[model samples]
Target: MTIRIRTALLGAALAGTAATSAVAEEWRLNNFLPETRPETAQIEQFAEDVNAALADKDFKLTVYSGGSLGLKNTDLLRVLPRGAVEMSLMWSNYLGRDAPALSSVFVQGAISTVDELKAVLPVAQEIYEEEYTDWGVTTVGFVAIPTLSVSVFCRDEPIHTLEDLKGVKLRVWAREQVETFTKLGVAAQIIPQEETYVALKTGVVDCALYPALYASTISLQEVTKYASFLYPMASAPYTLGVATDKWESTDPEIRTAITTAADALWERTNQYDKDAEAEMAAREKLGEMGVTWGEDFPEADRAQFMEAVSETWQMLAEEAGGNAMDYRARVLEALGR
Candidate 1:
């Protein structure tokens, strides 16, 4: 055989072996919640799509759930950057480390519903941007996971108006939430998810603020007789970030392939979340589950509710960092809001 032909065959074999090695790298994912949650399920699908795109993929990605990896909502910023954990699909509410400023993005009663959220996030992400690059992490833009409307579960009665919220103790997770509720005279009980339900039931908390998904998941509706049609909080927005150190060590082609695959998958992933929420609403509509959405209440009450939400922005901008007078101007320029 000619030397040229022999060299060509050898080069081809080596190229094939390198591709095989790249595909063989397994991705290990970590989750603080149970595998049953929709976020985990959708991530599982993302992994599948990523695997399909690998050239020589031996992709083995196993998800460890329920905080088995020892990371919680609070530890994500440190854990993810240090490579103590690989990837996380958790929300901004859990973070307080690198960006305490991010805490203000969820100012209660300002933005509600997904469309409002989508419009608001571009501004919010800019306020307290995660410094992933410094920590050797590659940030995948925000992911919208399917969750439901925020409802306040109170011991006595659901808050129907700004005046109604007075003298109530409400569980608020974000700094903005605390400020918003406190300004309205509700005592802010700053606590995590696991403790919130018990607080509401035992009277430790006069009220608990959470998504409608929590209503079914934790049975908040059963203990609290009144369900407010008041969905005051924004849907929790989670980021998709990867370990930069690991990513840099990984082959360029693999990174390209994975990112490309993820972008493609996200198109569907977002739609899936929004779609699932619709189904949840449909199920609720089909059955009269004693609960009422504030939108369904009397027209007079609706006018009152609209008036209550109007007071949110000024204070929300103040708590965000500054009076955010400058920001308010910028946002008005950007969104004309």
Candidate 2:
């Protein structure tokens, strides 16, 4: 009897172990940027926070940065719903093809500053959640980077005026950017961010519209000699999303923990944006790398550029239609425009 009782206890212990192992969940997060970028760092911090919060739960998050998983930025939304990826950090511009509404924040001349974008963030989140839900995903957080403004990084020459942009083969990402640049007589070329350095180095594109910080991140300063601070293009915001079914299956406590972590990430990102020393250090680093910074466009020139890009905004609003159109209206109203 003693021997039989001992064997039964051992069998029960093995079953419990197997059940616990089966219940454990591993989530994969895909980030397109290199580990050095602030965005990547923010996501990494988020993962750590989640892990710590859920220490008692059978949940673990693994982050794959620098596109190590071989998934492009554009592939994130498509794959996340299909279960190919559990989570992703994606840019709004990349989703413009299928969901133009999500990209409304990036409409040229529509949102001029980070503050204006923040003003509409609540509505933007709602809109994004609706769209993400439709596509079988759940949005957890938003990552916004603060910069002086989106600028033109040129290889051979500085684009100081509208005339200088004429006939320039500028690399563009979204359709709206293409329209905006085309109005200024620029030959816009849509290319992947990963391919930008080589394109700029090989003269495939004379200039590209990117954030000022990219000079250090992608070594754009090496290939591009001049950075032109142009019209105040809206910052391209990044979204954190998880597969809908996975999110639904998660325990309520675990979901709350993830939400709490996401809120902390938002606060951290906002503080990072407000840190002037960090911005200056990045700019100084770019200067040390031999990249010349052009003056901000003259007030009159800036006004003219804004006016020219207004048409692109109108086109995007019309193309977006439905919920996207409503979202843009909310954002514009919030901007007091």
Top candidate when judged by lDDT against the true structure: 2
lDDT of 2 at 221: 87
The lDDT, on a scale of 0 to 1, for candidate 2 is 0.78
lDDT of 2 by residue, 1-337 (tens): 6999999999999999999887868888888888878778888899999999989888898899888889877666788888888888877778877777776655655666667767766766777778888888898887776644667888988887777777588887777778877777778888877789999999999998877765577778889988767765546467889898988987898888888988888887764355446555766787788888887667887787787677777677788886767767777787788
Question: Poorest 10 consecutive residues of model 2 by lDDT?
Answer: 271-280
Candidate 2 runs further than 4 Å off: 1-24, 272-279
lDDT, residue 212, candidate 1: 62
lDDT of each: 0.60, 0.78
TM-score of 2: 0.87
- Per-model TM against the reference: 0.72, 0.87
* Most accurate candidate by TM-score: 2
Q: How far in Å is the alpha carbon of 56 misplaced in model 2? A: 3.0
Q: Which ten contiguous residues of candidate 1 have the minimum total lDDT?
A: 290-299
For 152-226, candidate 1 gives per-residue lDDT tens digits of 666676565645666676787766566556555667768776666688778887777766654555556555656
